[model samples]
Target: MRTPAQNAHLALLLEVAGTPKPGNVDRHRDLEDLRFEHFLAGAVGAQRGLEQAANGGAVGPAFERSVEGMAAQGGGNTQFGALLLLVPLVRAAADDLSQPVVEAICEDTTVADAAGFYRAFDHVDVFVGEPPAEMEPLDVRRGSDAVPALEERGLTLLDIMEQSVPGDDVAREWVRGFERSFVAAERLAEADGPLTERAAAVFLSLLAERPDTLVATRSGEAVAQEVTERAAELVERNALETDRKIVERFADELVERGVNPGTTADITAAGLFIALERGAITV
Candidate 1:
């Protein structure tokens, strides 16, 4: 039998799978859409708890520690288990919702499977330009590697939100609206050109609070700038090399603790490699 937490997560997933999609809905269609929406809302609420845990909140420390311990184990680890658990949740949500929008999210997840999570950082490096000439080469490379790892980790965490919460229709509709808004804003930013520094800063400020905004915004330049600034800040405030090593060590420790880490490490490593090969560090 699934534990109470797992049961709760499954319940939330069911809710999101049932919500209504925007624009394409016909009132003539049955109340099944509405019921789905209701379930989706509840699932989203439950997912917040899961996200917090995945992101290193107090509630998820044990799980995080377990992941770390699994990483220590030579081949398998906690991250792999997390992925296995996560894949089913997302897949179920997609299957239940049967909407284009939900399918899009599933598509994105599928792409993630192909590309791995860390690939997004390549866009970030391109946005930020090159580090100062005086900065150590090792530091730059390590920093570059670290950014993608964190991004991949974040995506892994988002899997909980995407899969566990439920309401495919509602979530997809919300995603559509968000995309529309982001596209509009990006257009405005692009037209402004180099004058967009302030706009870029504002965008990043908003992104810090709402990362999802990037999906909707059309201005790759603006998004890139925001990512660059954020990455720089992380480098200045923390040692990228040290942080990367620590994360690796944590995974190692998790393995020693008897948790499976193979999936996370494979995904993370793949992402890092992709970023390194495809990413641009200089503007």
Candidate 2:
């Protein structure tokens, strides 16, 4: 039996190993600043913190440690959001793999967990949208500098995620009992073929289902919607199974345009972890 930490590590590897992930780095694709090998290195480096989470460490600290380790590689922020989801999920898996279990783990987060989450930003470059005028003082870009404000507000990690939920899909997952991750796990379980291929197909399904927030942040909301529309069309045609070149072409176009559906990739990683722990996906 594989440990949750081991499965988490494998989830990272498999996510990146799934080819043609549309603008994201994968076995057959790489962005200018990110590469396939960097992701591989990141997965290896993230093992320590993953183990900590599996050992029942606090979510914030384990997540910060994971980001620190992931950043030890040349790739910057290869799996920050993914680890944000994985730490809590790994902790939940240590006990039980259910929505309520994970939700409780997230809701149990403390102000210190919020502090550690902010500190993780110190280790790498994560592109986040600007905070609302009222929340500026709590902006993630402030990193540890925002801790005082967070402390004053008595904001826990879950609280922080709730504040961010309107704008960030990953944050939405945290506050919503990881609903999308669980849904994706179901999709993975129902899909056929190699796990890697299932991941790729699921990646497309996710992209088609929602506009990637990273794309909206990097490009624009218009562009993000357009990307989603294109993916939906491809998926409707069953391109992933019947005509892979069509999917690869879309991936190529996105790569050339420098538009990465990073948030979608992060969700895919989280879903893979859930599926692994549930025995829906096995190594």
Among the numbered candidates, top TM-score falls to 2
Find the 10 residues in a row with the least total lDDT in model 2: 73-82
Candidate with the greatest lDDT versus the true structure: 2
> Each candidate: RMSD to true structure?
23.0, 0.9
Task: Write down the lDDT of every candidate, Cα atoms only.
Answer: 0.29, 0.92
Q: Over the stretch 22-63, how does candidate 2's per-residue lDDT look in tens digits?
A: 988988998887998899989998999999999999999999
lDDT of 1 by residue, 8-110 (tens): 3442232122111111111111132233343333333334333433343332232222233223332221132222233222233323312353334344443
Q: How far is candidate 2 from the true structure (C-alpha RMSD, Å)?
A: 0.9
> Pairing residues by index, what is the TM-score of model 2?
0.98
